[model samples]
Target: MHRLITVALAVALGLGAGSQAAVPFYDTYQLQCRANFGAAFNLPAGSFFTSSTPAINNAGQVAVNLVNVNVPGNPPGVWFGQGGTGQVKFVAADSNATIGSISLNHLGRAVFPQNFTSPNGVYFYDAPSDTSGLLTTQPIGASSFGTPIVNDLGQVGYRVSFLGSNAWVSFAGAPPVAFHAVEAALDAASPYSFLFTPSFNNSRQIAGKVRLGAAGQTGENRPDQIRIINPDGTFTIIAHDRDSDPNSLFLSFDNSVALTDNGWVAFNANLFPAGRGVFFSNGVETRTIAVNTAGIVSTIESFGPAASASGLVAFRAFENNTALRAIWIGDGTTLRRVVREHDIVPTDLGPARIDQHDASPVFGGSITINRYGDVAFNAALTPPDNNQIEWGSGIFVALARTPGDVDCDGDVDFDDIDAFVAALSGPAAYAAQYPDCRWLNADCDGDGDVDFDDIDPFVALIGS
Candidate 1:
């Protein structure tokens, strides 16, 4: 089975030309299922669900706002749980509030926004303390602050109301740093650009949306933006609504942007003459990794990108006007679909293999990818019923595998040999292209580095 998949990758990736860009073969690992999600709740019979916006840290620790509802209860309260095994542990609870977002850092701690509650505001959860604390309790009022994100250094950043965002850093002995409003830095450039949907990285960088005009503008004039706030207080407007920069030709930068530890920001943008697509920038050069079915730029969702420090990017895309949807991954140079609608996937039902997937239409859907090449996402499973189709929503995780599977088609063929040679000659060049990735695949001998020792292993891989 592995050999066949490898061959498919080699042929599909156009490896005969020895392109360095590669597609990856992923080993899918089912971490939890609908039963697992329901198991987290101690509800009556069948009331179960977590917030659609789930988070996964680098250590594979997934944090979910498990919604535990009871029969005839006032409202559902969001519970927090972690890890793959065992029932979920207890966390904070709040009725009359629907959490817009929850983000987990490397330490498993999280900061999120809660709207529709008394003193509506954002809160923080610390695993070490096993307690939830307040970042700000003042009413969020509107869904202005997209989602609050946290870093390992106890630095949390989020938008406040509709004005802008602020970063709150915690110090042990001193009073928490006064909210360092990044918007204050942004207003210097674009006057009254209401910032929303701020994301954070360990490097103290934040990327988010900045509304160009006043509130209540909903049309071609509606607000849309993409901005990156550096730690040094300098800000860059990647794209915005009605932007007229002839060089890039972007009609509008969508509302969501994902940030990684090294400051790589990925966002979906609508481009003039190019359509919509996912773009990644390191505050330097920007590249549109994926385009539409006609090779035109496009994106599946508004906030549709999840990135990792290992240079792996996960996103969803589809044809311009079709139900054919696909989830894709980009390994710096090449972008390839991991799964698609109507694609057959093996199931444990013994004789039944489900091939169709149901698409989710919710904004800010929980899609994630880690540095280790593991992808966590939520999609609906479509199985044929009696002349009908039944949909079952599920959360999944896939691990990237197959070394030398450049162009990640899963095959290690002659194309890999040439690509590997180029990578070996100057790994720095390749690393520069994939700053978040450390493609150590050339270490065929199982040694740490891709050095001379890997030559024999490379030969064996080909001979096999």
Candidate 2:
């Protein structure tokens, strides 16, 4: 199945034997993983990972939460590791301390919060610094809240507030500054209610859910909305419908929001009795993004939604009639299913894998998208019955599909030939080889078969 190319052609192209674009983001391809069940690189012992989602960065690094089962108490916390490696690494572990939520930035720095004890538990552990410490030592009432976030500039965002009291968005700086707080975050009412912590952009803009009372409307009450707090301290209402609409119906937003560096906001909202769906706000207009209009019935959209800088939104949606669940990525214009249950993955790792369970929805299993159009998601794997261990649950990273990056490692290299060869062997072989990768239509030359005729064009494309 090897493509017979002249040595001169291979050398002139500057690519080795296996170099080629594996596939496109919307089509057949194998998924490259960044983290999976294994021993911790730091502990060098076996570990167990929960069903929670992991954070990913542009460098293909994954921030995973691992519980070291080898330890007596089975202490669990955050760790950083890359795919294809034999080890997941430990980031931090404090005795009796619990890591609430963790997010990794583009720089691979991980920001996480431990128990409600403020000025003591919250910290940013930098792999390069080989250190960890209190980002904010100020006393924050233990509200059992707060999701730690790290941005591109290494800025960390954390929410500090007691239940029903004032809320503050604290950033770890030379001196921690609350990005927004009770009396200061909003301009509407005397008492402000903050729901979820605001999501931040590279420009330091923040998008959050807050409740504001609506006046001069019949039956239209105060609605929870997504608002953006700009660098100048002024806020813009990205999504809120506590007012009269042209259809005389009222709309409201959910507590979750994800914003990108380009000021696009992807938020969850209730469109009255029509059911909840994701809405996109580009500053001027906010409209409900449709999951599908082609289905027999309306596609049932699940609540958890994640948006990327390039305007791509990743979420779970299912067919109303068939109940066929799928993970989809949409760019407001084109929508495609990224993965679905039972689909085979094409990989060079000798054997393919399959998606065993639905990608975890929303809060627990979120689709983490990086700038390269790569997405990191969590899924349960179908175990191969042939003496291989149970494929268990794990986090997987999918590249946007580079044509010759057949190995799905995000580039065209000498390693893709084996994977491409497997893909040419048909779906059954592909599934057997890489259960996590989906079969591709590798008919490169449009000859109706993925055979010899496809070689020249594929090689030329890779060279170009």
Scanning candidate 2 in windows of ten residues, the lowest lDDT window is: 212-221
lDDT of 1 at 39: 29
lDDT by candidate, in order shown: 0.55, 0.56
Q: Candidate 2's residue-wise lDDT over 1-464, tens digit each?
A: 23444343355457444433232364433333322355222323455555556677777777766543345555555666666342434433444555655678877687776663333445666666655666664434535436667788876655665443445464646564655535323334433434465677776777777764322211225445567776545777665564423342226655567888888898766665556566678668765555344442255354457777656677767645555566666665546667665555543333435444334431235677765556776655544333244344545666565355445453455554566667667778866876654344344565445655655665665665
Overall local distance difference test of candidate 2: 0.56
The candidate maximizing TM-score is 2
Given candidate 1, what's the lDDT at residue 44?
31
* Candidate 1: residue 120 lDDT (0-100): 62
* Per-residue alpha-carbon lDDT of candidate 1 for residues 1-464, written as tens digits (9 for 90 to 100): 33553454355444334323334555354543332223222223343443365577666656554454443443433334443332333333555655656777878687766666554666676666777755665322233444667778877666565343333222222344333333333335433335555677776667776655433323455545566666454667666555434455567776677887777788877767756667787757776677553452244655458887656677877644445666778855677666555544433321112233223441125577755566665544444442134333444555565465433333566756555654565578656554433356665665557765666666556545
